[model samples]
Target: MNNYYQVSASYDDVGNILSITRRGLVPDANCFTPQEIDRMTLVYDTPSNRLLRVGDLAPTPYRPYGFKPGVSPSAEYVHDNNGNLTFDPHKGLMMQYNFLNLPTSIGAMSLTYDATGRKWKKDGEFGEVEYDNGVEYRDGVLEAIYAPDGRLVAEYPSGGNRSEGDISRFVAEYWHQDHLGNTRLAFADFNEDSFIEIKDNPSTGENELEITQESHYYPFGMGHMGHGMLLLLQRIGTCSMVLKEMKTWG
Candidate 1:
């Protein structure tokens, strides 16, 4: 169990909290509190103490179930070999939940990256959503494939779906990032629909695509503030519309 002190607090090698707990001042100092964690800055460091991911945790108040009106009790942190809370298993770098933790009618940034590492990627999955995992870029761009049980059956690129290409083609066209700079996220109207493309990774990017079929349309604006406050303002409406459209489209 590694020690985690408040950003403003100090510590000693002997394991002494030289500063007060960040939670001492709920609604103010309690950055991890239900409200604050939902709207504070987050920075994760690697085992070498280098910054890994910077993002938020987001609040989960509107859920039909779970925390009535505050942060949910299901939140958790992810650690490398050093056990540093560099990532949130429930809420990855961009604050997106993983396959197991995602809400039925919601979404989260399921990918993230550091200086120049493949933080997360979509490996692909099978029917509906068996398992989708793959590789990612430093700027948070993701490239994941999906498979129902285990075989590589489907693929989702950063830009869009390449129904004509195989796994290698998916990697060549969508996986590689330009040296221009961090990839900025862009919405695509594949079928002239106003849906935000969802890459398997967390950070948004151009040319990204959504998987799972036309059944799932795009939901808008699902990210986190510094601490953990989830900014899901437009998400509810968009997600609802997408799901409804998918039901009819199918």
Candidate 2:
């Protein structure tokens, strides 16, 4: 685990946090980060407030994530016009998102949306594709089933694949009303007991896609600091960068 104590911040003329330098960042005793896992600099297209690049730099460092030893460092991210993250040169993990910036695909997996803009389907890799493990959504209610490949699967009304036979994996992870779900993962871990924990191993310096910038707001989904405390933040797991502040006051 790494804990950041002192932090230095730089902002654009418009007051967007362009960079945050985390000093006194201490990893665990056995951490590979040499006490200087310094800064994650974010570049934005101010007119759109869209994040263009996230460069993770600290003096001179090696490639982050779980890459092999001695490899050179890499720029953190490369994003698309629609705000979809197209590349993460560090992990070789590339993804595409819909115009709304909802993730459509990661690496080989692909997602498709319905005419109404709901997630419709998620296709698996190549011929190995089967209906074994997938999710189905209806009227916005999401249900999932896990089976093996080559098995027939039913398609959900909103989008994605559903199970047709005995589940090869666990059953419905959980259920909840749509408004204001607060987990950082969104729905990746529906079950509370087994919420996914993608942590950056101090011993390994292995990191995953992490949200670096966040704000709390007054109105829903928008940043309005003039309103009240936490007016900029609506909920966790929400992408505030794309959610333009609606007004200065509620």
Candidate 3:
């Protein structure tokens, strides 16, 4: 028998509505697990359509799991004269600055273009740099990825190293083992070209330098808020190394 049911109703109390319940089912030989039970609730500000406080027997002291109902800290937004959403140096996204925001580093902006020619979000220093007329695009794709000063950091698939497809093309079992496993992250040179190499240990949250047969040590660049400098180093058909190891005292 499909044993599943919910009980709910409303009552008036101090200009609000209250709900109560008690539910369970007798177990059988095939299914011996005890039935779940949940009770006590309340609703307030009925006229305005709101649940202010719930209780015990009926519903008392309503407490939202993550947060109670209330107005959060106020935040201001920035917009250009055309009313386009702009990034404020103070408030980045979600009404707060990300941990990566550094005072020394010049704030950079990233603009995303949809299929249409319409300008979407213009963030950070992108607002500062005037768009050059020579910027190229092909088949709705930006042909040139440039720096703030208009220098070509990378071209399309052939020039700069930017893979736009599913990352599974590079990583094996990308999503499966995220814990202490043999699978680690490394920046593939693709053609064995000496560009930049990076590797990290998911278990220790540490990033380690991956070395080559020629004994070339590629430094691991740690962005802001990196957990630890430790790294998980591994070479296929070979051994691996760890950065900083933590030892237990007691």
User: Evaluated with TM-score, which candidate comes out highest?
Assistant: 2
lDDT of 1 at 84: 36
| lDDT (10s digit) by residue, model 1, range 1-250 | 2111122434445444333212111232434333222222333343344333332333333231111222433444544443334454334333233334431222332333333442333222321222224422222332344232212223445476444452333321222122432222222234335554555544745445643222111021222223223235444756743433446665
State how far residue 27 of model 1 sits from its true place (Å).
24
Model 3 TM-score, 2 decimals:
0.21
> Comparing 1 and 3 by lDDT, which wins?
3
Worst 10 residues of 3 by lDDT: 215-224
lDDT of 2 by residue, 83-104 (tens): 6678766556788876667787
After best superposition, candidate 2 residue 233: deviation in angstroms?
A: 39
Question: Where does candidate 1 have its weakest 10-residue lDDT segment?
Answer: 214-223
lDDT of 1 at 78: 49
Candidate 1 deviant stretches above 4 angstroms: 1-37, 41-78, 83-89, 92-122, 126-180, 185-250
Evaluation by TM-score, superior candidate among 1 and 2: 2
Runs of candidate 2 exceeding 4 Å displacement: 1-8, 23-36, 44-52, 59-103, 124-180, 184-250
Clashes in model 3: which pairs?
54-59, 54-60, 55-59, 55-60, 56-60, 206-230, 207-230, 207-231, 208-231
**Which candidate number has the best lDDT?**
2
What is the Å distance of residue 77 in model 1 from its true position?
2.1
Error of 2 at 119 (Å): 1.4
